[model samples]
Target: MNAKDPITVLPTDTAVSQRAARELLSSIEQAQRSFGVASVVLTGGTIGIQVLRDVRAFVENGFTEADFSKVEFWFGDERFVARASDERNEKQAREALLDHVGVPEDRIHAMGAAGEFETVEEAAEAYARELTAHAAADSTLPRFDVLLLGMGPDGHIASLFPGTGLIDAQGLTTAVRDSPKPPPERVSLTRSTISSAREVWLVVTGEGKADPVAAAFAGEPADVVPAGAVAGVESTRWFLDEAAHSKAAERGA
Candidate 1:
């Protein structure tokens, strides 16, 4: 896929849900055709969970389980305080999709559990080292085929909230502290690194997200709501349900 103008909106949540499923399947097909392997990054939140669940069902519904074996999974961002076994993004993913599916253990590289590292900084450094070591032999960075993300009501993604120091990071990952949201500690991929992905897909819903969704696509250039930094090397998509898109058309109108 190539970078294009913002996709204004989807008709409803059901439509958004169905499109997410098709998109993941298409990513799998494209990766298989292009690189012989497909790598996907996952996020956590309402729509995030919906996307995963939908994919799991899609795969179960004959999308081909064999394709999953060739897929590698990564996290877009992670909390620094919760154990991976806790009910967080990585945990939910393992329970909801990975564990239930056939993606190999080695192929699923999740962030460290809260207590795995002595400090968030250590955690961030460890993840960075992992990514750097896994970089393609010819390139220091690997272009993720697809990165599924969710927008915070305040416009955050991963742990890259607005006004956070991590926003300016040149590294792949960074330690965050005192996050405005609870469980203040977190590790997140920086904007520079995230922008390296081949495609960035945002699944946002609800009236609460309408303003920020409109703002980010409207070229507001604000960083506090980190989603405003919505850019990717190849493509960026806003897969918004009606609630999130309600204000979008008006913004254009």
Candidate 2:
């Protein structure tokens, strides 16, 4: 569970999604067994969307409907665009899994979109408020059983990029602008909020992510590699494909 050295699991590129899907389902079931409901934070990226599709396929093959229903989903980050936009993580998730799942509508918590709020900051604040409302009185965050994230090739987690003020932002969420990637604006859960989860899983693929993955495991500074800043309370896992873990292997991680 150490931030500097998480448990790493490497699977083939073609099989990584399926493995992540299976692990996610198993985690959800275990959480439900211990608690009446489980909260999971989802991420968005090419591999992330693939994992969602794999999860849906797994459910169709054998998973129980009740197991899916007992889990609540939240986004770790979201683009500040229209709800239906391709850039919207919630949209891709719905197309890949949520829309086909038996989970309750109210259980899927997504950040506000462009038209829903006046600014990205407003959207971030809205999501934070919603999260706080669902949290226990003594805590500022929900009991997140599992939090899945996708690391940017540059080592960013959620929307926290290197040298960005949002990387050190306080509270549950923060607004991102002029992102190194496209869309320019976004709403993301802060490092503190993401690290609060009981389990944090980084599902990464592609050789493009290899360097960052290695840097994270190498114990790079959070300001330089945001992914290194996050760790879970119980466990932190890095689920990577062979390509993604290549550099990490060289580092003896």
Candidate 3:
């Protein structure tokens, strides 16, 4: 889908998160009904984690139904930190939603942790192999029903920072070193890999994000704004709160 597609703006961060929860459940439910199993790429950030928390609440409060067990969970990116570290997205996600939903342990495809591999490159390679293992026949990667992402204020997405070669990296997953945002070491799906998903959602919030949101939607180069570098094979969507959408709206996005 074109980058010029749909943009959903909510009045508040809470409202945006709640709406994202509903969207997530609907995506998973549709995939499960069609093939009995669904796959989604999870992202991490203030809004990203909030959305997961909202999803759990929605399911528990009966606002929606979700077969979390029927869905495979994968991280879009991971800090190459100790498994129990607070910087680990896998750890945060587990505490936020995975545990609450009682999703099958085997279905969570987390990246290799700090202690699990000798090097960040090894961790990234291992994750790529893990993805290959779950891939559909005749393919090297699993079908992602929904690929969620949280954009950095600088317009980076999924660890692919602007002005870095990682923004145009090749392969399914790659190791990130010297990240502008720390825990310098990380593992992330490549930009090309992220774009391979059936649906991609860039969920962002806050006034701090307005500048890059504007630049990205304006068709900036990948080297200048990694967020604009990729698009889903089927659909690409921008989910933002009022503040985050401000500049983009001004640009007539």
Q: 69-90 in candidate 3: lDDT tens per residue?
A: 7889999999999999998999
Model 2 scores worst on lDDT over the 10 consecutive residues at: 1-10
Give per-residue CA lDDT, model 1, range 4-123, as digits (tens): 545636778767877887778887888888999998889988778777788788878887534778888888888876674465688888877888778898988878767778898898
**Model 3 Cα displacement at 119 (Å)?**
0.4
Off by over 4 Å in 2: 1-6, 64-66
Give residue 126's lDDT in candidate 3 (0 to 100).
Answer: 97
Cα RMSD (angstroms) for every candidate in the order listed: 2.2, 1.6, 1.1
Highest-TM-score candidate: 3
Clashing pairs in 1: 162-224, 163-224
Kindly list the per-residue Cα lDDT of model 2 for residues 23-71, writing each as its tens digit. Answer: 8988888888889898899999988899999999888988643377778
**Model 1, stretches more than 4 Å misplaced?**
1-3, 6-8, 64-66, 82-85
C-alpha-based local distance difference test score of model 1: 0.79
Clashes of 3: 0
State TM-scores per candidate. Answer: 0.93, 0.95, 0.97
Q: Sort the candidates on TM-score, descending order.
A: 3, 2, 1
